[model samples]
Target: MNPNLLTPPRRHGERPTTTGLEIPHDQLDMFSPPRVRAELVKQAQALPGVFTGPSQVSEPSSLALRLRQPLGPWEAFLHPSTDEFGHIHRAGFLHLTLPRPLLAPLVEAGWAEQHPISLRPEWPDTIVMLYAPRDDGELDVVLAALRASWQQASTEKGR
Candidate 1:
């Protein structure tokens, strides 16, 4: 894996609004606001094998990314609610390929939930969706989890 994959103090992408984001307004909460969502998208885009576009968004407003290393779809967006054909997913959330050993602890800690490998058959192991952070403290925790997930994906690919 690249040692300098994602470092802090980096620039993020465009700010997500209630109109162009993939997630709907009802889904937004203090846990995951537009600012936080934008930050998450910015960070994810900083990693390798990530792309943002109409391929992930049905509309021009949707802010989402398609990752290749782990090979999955993720969104760090809100607003412009998700339509039936949209591939953009929840903001501040992640679906990752995690080992069963790791999954159990995350679930017990209320940090994650099993998302079923059926959603992404190409993945080698079971995946989980880490929830959006509820506050700054939770954002830190969520970022750590996301980093770990990205590491796992990179390691699996022998990057």
Candidate 2:
């Protein structure tokens, strides 16, 4: 992926609070209102090659965004059972995988942080916990991030 295009503008405002862990990982502040969350999910599901379903690696209540046909290898997924590159948490934040090259920029820009689990030697370093979107403008940035993730997960060269 081209880092230039995938790199989003620095997110405005202080970063929302987050738990930064796997089991209870979540955004603790600045949650998206129900209407905004719903709209974000709707638009994400409408992206090309995406389909929503129960998340195999997250809380059952969360929405999994899976590629209809994942072309990349297992490294592209957070878990192979669902081929999920990302999922929207109940609290409205997201857990997703991005290309390794994009991780630092995304985090430095205040858009996301590295998933704690990814710190382990066995895990891919691409996993990140994306902060929740609190409004329409933020939702647009989140969707753009998700779209980059989808493209990475679906392409053979994603790794």
* Highest lDDT model number: 2
> What does candidate 1's lDDT look like per residue over 1-159, in tens digits?
222213322213322222212222222332466677667767766766655664332344544444454422222211122211112244555444444456666666656555543244443444455566545555666566566555554443323
Clashing pairs in 1: 1-159, 20-61
* Highest TM-score against the true fold, candidate: 2
Find the 10 residues in a row with the least total lDDT in model 2. 1-10
lDDT of 2 by residue, 1-159 (tens): 222524677789999887756546678898889998998799888988888988988888999998888886566788645478889987789999987777888899898998888887777778889888888877887877887788888888534
Model 2 TM-score, 2 decimals? 0.88
